[model samples]
Target: MATAAVFLDRDGVINKDKGYVSQIDDFEFIDGSIEAMQLLKAHGYLLVVITNQSGIARGYYTEEEFMTLTEWMDWSLADRGVDLDGIYYCPHHPGKGIGDYKQDCLCRKPNTGMLDSAGKELDIDFANSYLVGDKLSDIQAGQKLQLKANYLVSTGKVLCEKGAEAADGVFTDLLSVAKAIVNG
Candidate 1:
């Protein structure tokens, strides 16, 4: 039997999109995020967080700091009965990256590298899975893999624009999207 997942874009979908959230103190969850995650998990969707951490490549923050915040977020979610099956991120910026981080890597969102990584590592049924993101890049990333559904939340840069056309659904936030996923 194949497994299905709900791929989430971390920055805006999981937490606030106040730019690069590197510090623990700066981290904050969106309202109903924990409950939504738990609901998805209860519905048998393996929660996978896929984010693009350009701050890591831009020298704005170190990968260690990113990892630290991520670990803290993971535990925070776990406390609420939302255990993520996987977390993947990209730390590359072709132009803004510094030194080793400077490169046009395929793992970046809108490239599908991260989705491919998750698909290969897990029993992900891409054609039957769902992706919820706050950016156009996130939609393009999963759509490239033929995901069952793609949703864009009105919480990031893509808002106020016609990003709705790119997604299967558009909502005020992830919780609304999760509601449809869990109930539908």
Candidate 2:
């Protein structure tokens, strides 16, 4: 009787991907994103955020900044009656990262480390879960874990047409993805 979750990518999926948006002013939730999250939450879906934070490794921002932003984002979501179960991010880049972040890490997307961790802590049934992201790496990660569903949204780096080819389904944005998950 394990729980299942909806893994989400932060950038583009949550907010606009305006390039390393570490500032509060730059953070903007996509249209209907909050309502979508609320719907998912109401349906007993555990919301988990899995993101690749190369900005920290690239020296564009610090982990503390990232944490601050997460706090704000979480608070905002809570305001809209959406509560997230957990959030995981990888600061490693393997090539473009600086110092310790330059090396490969298991928590990075395209790998199942974060999902594995969540499975352990949240009792997530990977085969019964879903992942929504705007990149191939996100789809790759979901496939790696053999998740029940993988959704690619066209609101980010990967367009819907392109992501649709690789994902279980393509969505216009997080809101659409949310609706599909709740009502599908």
Candidate 3:
């Protein structure tokens, strides 16, 4: 009775990582990402965005700014006929955080905090879920949760060392992964 999900990393995977994007003007979707998402939806996969918004912790941006941008993105996607199931973000960084945000938390990627929370709340089947990330921590997070597959994308920061080993496969972008998912 559990539904399958596609865990997505915000920066590099969903939107262009324009250096801690906190403003709507800075947020840009990767080409074809919206179309790919439509395909995923048609195939019946719940879409969840799990991101690390360390800018909030580092005092680079306020929580309100982040929320505003998030709302814009979600609304824009909705206009394109794609509605995300859940959007979860961790505003923490152990070293760089200024105040209460400074802590080593399990919600960060490579840990399964965000993923586990979404699964419990959204009825996701972890073993059947898939993850698409550009960083090694993203792949590690899905691996720790033992998802069906984890893909490393060429966009974003593109962690190459340990991430390659952790990833189930590497792709040019999210659209290619979408095609593979729809066809596979």
Candidate 4:
């Protein structure tokens, strides 16, 4: 059977969006973010992270560094009994990328490449799934996939009025979104 997932954006939704967060020392989970994942897990929603890591393409960090940080994050969440189903990132930037990192890849946000990959690899049912992100591009990606709902969380960057209006729902934080999903 296909799984129902709650696709998440990494920087804003899971951790504080410190620009180019490449080191473990700089990574900080937003308040209640871990608990929110736990709640979603308890409710049988597969927690998958889909993010655009343009910092890598821009030479701010290496893909190895990103993977190391991701490993640490997975372990940290495992300690809390919240196992992430998957993590998909786009390390390409059509502009300002160094070397081979500069290309218009399909995995970037505002595009559904990452989501499409997740759906196939994880057998995700898009119509039964949902997305929670901090930017307009995140919502747009989910919308393109025809997910059941797309939510905007305000923990990272501030959304413009137009961006907020585009979301199926808007909330203060990831925990709030989890509550709404679990209860409603």
* Best by the lDDT measure: 4
Candidate 3: lDDT over CA atoms? 0.92
Pitting candidate 3 against candidate 4, the one with the higher TM-score is 4
- How does model 4 fare in lDDT? 0.95
Q: Across residues 44-140, which tens digit of lDDT does each residue of candidate 3 receive?
A: 9999999999999999999999999999999999999999999999999989998899999999887889999999999999888999999999998
- List candidate 4 stretches off by more than 4 Å: none
Model 1: how large is the Cα RMSD against the reference?
A: 1.0
TM-score of 4: 0.99
lDDT of each: 0.89, 0.89, 0.92, 0.95
Over 59-89, each residue of candidate 4 has an lDDT whose tens digit, in order, gives 9999999999999999999999999999999
Candidate 2: stretches off by over 4 Å: 160-162
Rate residue 54 of model 4 by lDDT: 95
Error of 2 at 183 (Å): 2.0
Per-residue alpha-carbon lDDT of model 1 for 27-142, expressed as tens digits?
Answer: 88988878889988998998999999999999999999999999999999988888999999999999999998999999998999888888889889988899999877888887
Candidate numbers, best lDDT first, in rank order? 4, 3, 1, 2
Q: Which candidate, 1 or 3, has the higher TM-score?
A: 3
TM-score (C-alpha, index-matched) for candidate 2: 0.96
Q: How many backbone clashes does every candidate have?
A: 0, 0, 0, 0
C-alpha lDDT of residue 105 in model 4: 86
